[model samples]
Target: MSVMLLIEQVLNGLQYGVMLFLMAAGLTLVFGVMGLINLAHGSLYMVGAFACAGVAAATGSFWLGLAASLAAAAAAGALVEVAVIRRLYDRDHLDQVLATFALILVFSEGTRWLFGSFPLYLSVPEVLSGAVTLPGGIEYSLYRLAIIVAGFAVAAGLFWLIGRTRLGVRIRAGESDREMIAALGVDIRKLYTVVFALGAALAGLAGALVGTIQSVQVGMGEPVLILAFVVIVIGGIGSIKGALVGALLVGMTDTLGKVLLPVAFGTVMDASDATAIGSALASMLIYILMAGVLIYRPQGLFGEAH
Candidate 1:
């Protein structure tokens, strides 16, 4: 409707997209480097949330909770990699999917057992508890803006890590040919573990960040996990740049569709019908985009032509 409203929605979409990027970034890495389909990645996200909530509640410090979330998720990830996932690495896709799917059940049940079915709420820190005025005189939440900044920072960091560092080189080598990297004296197993842990840590960070805004509860990671899958698929399975672009595209498309479509349809139809139609289409918008992308570029927007 108004310019202010439009800007607000755009910001909301950006924030949402960045969060998806966090999830998708790790997912793409795992798929690209390891060729493993981890269905339990979302469980790592849940693990981070519960870890954050528990620590925050116990210590009365959100920062401590955040740290705990990362540690817990990373440790859990490393453990899963060594114990179960290692076995599945050379297995078929169905086996990997089944094993990780089992992990999702295990993590969810264990979380429910430890935390109970009740949801946990995190308090926004005092410094980030207020709103700030943006350039257009629009008031926005400091916490949300903080999320946007943090997400971008991570993206930059990832770019540097993958593009500049020795680890990045090793990772690229591994992706191109695992056997060759091992032959060249690289500890391929160790590299895979580190990558999985790193990806899991990213997912954890996302969970901790989102936990404050949403409920920290059992099975909360599934929907986000699904969206993350859509992100990776649309972005191209192994491309970080594609993940970023696809996430933003999906985020903005979904958000704008929900808002603008309803308004546009309302002018030509009844309010109830317009709202229903808009909401339905909005939910499907990202998937529709994915289908379109796949039809045109089977590998994805950033995926290498195969």
Candidate 2:
């Protein structure tokens, strides 16, 4: 491959990794603080994408769509927490899983009913649609680069929110001992709602950003959701830093593996067979990485041991 092509792929991988971090960050936070396993988190992602697509299509304003995505996802998350998820907090993980699974069905069907089964396309905003030349004379898409910047900005903001603020302290305390925090007169219920909504907002932001690149449709979040789970697992559940590192690792490994494996195999096998085999192995690379990490560090790289 040309050096320029390799550079572009690397950029692509970085962009993808950052996006994964957005989703995984929320998943990790919710799990760490609330001790609730939510399967419908992806549905919030879908909600964001749908809200963005609908608003952008109606008003022809990407900014409006973006705002709508944040608002809609956060609102939905808060609503779910108050009406359903709040009940699951004291329940078993199995119950939480089942309830959230039911939520997935509701969300998917509800979205399909509203938007139809056809996928919606979100155009990149005019200002960000073009490509820019880098120092090495390689051209990269501006919108994708914007995503990388935006993702990192959000990550930084989240870290600060969790590490340096009053809410962060409360969150940490809740994570360590929910009963103690509640006894200390903390509004544990309200805190859980806020955290859930915050996590949903992050997922929604990721969905909105990704919608510009891919088709926005019902069930679109499931694949990314699974990947996000893998990210948190490999990074150590509940650790934002771990999520970031794991996401980047998975994204780069998946992207580069896909590109490089084919070339490596082409030397020894027929071109078609090499492409097929390379694609297959590339798909499995992250899972292999996940297993290796689990074997070496069961609590994950950043997780607290039980």
Task: Give the number of the best model, judged by TM-score.
Answer: 1
Cα shift from native, residue 297, model 1 (Å): 0.7
Deviating ranges (above 4 Å) for candidate 1: none
| The candidate that achieves the highest lDDT relative to the unseen native structure | 2
Estimate, for each residue in 1-306, the C-alpha lDDT of model 2 and write its tens digit. Answer: 899999899999999999999899889989998888989999999999999999999999999999999999999999999999988888999999999999999999999999999999999999999999889899989999999999889989989998999999999899999999999999999999999999999999899999989989999999999999999999998898999999999999999999999999999999999999999999999999999999999998889889
202-305 per-residue lDDT for model 1 (tens digits): 89989999999888999989999999999999999888999999999988998999999889989999999999998888888889999999999989999877
Q: Per-model C-alpha lDDT, please? A: 0.93, 0.94
The C-alpha stretches of model 2 lying farther than 4 A from their native spots are none
Candidate 1's TM-score: 0.99
TM-score of each: 0.99, 0.98
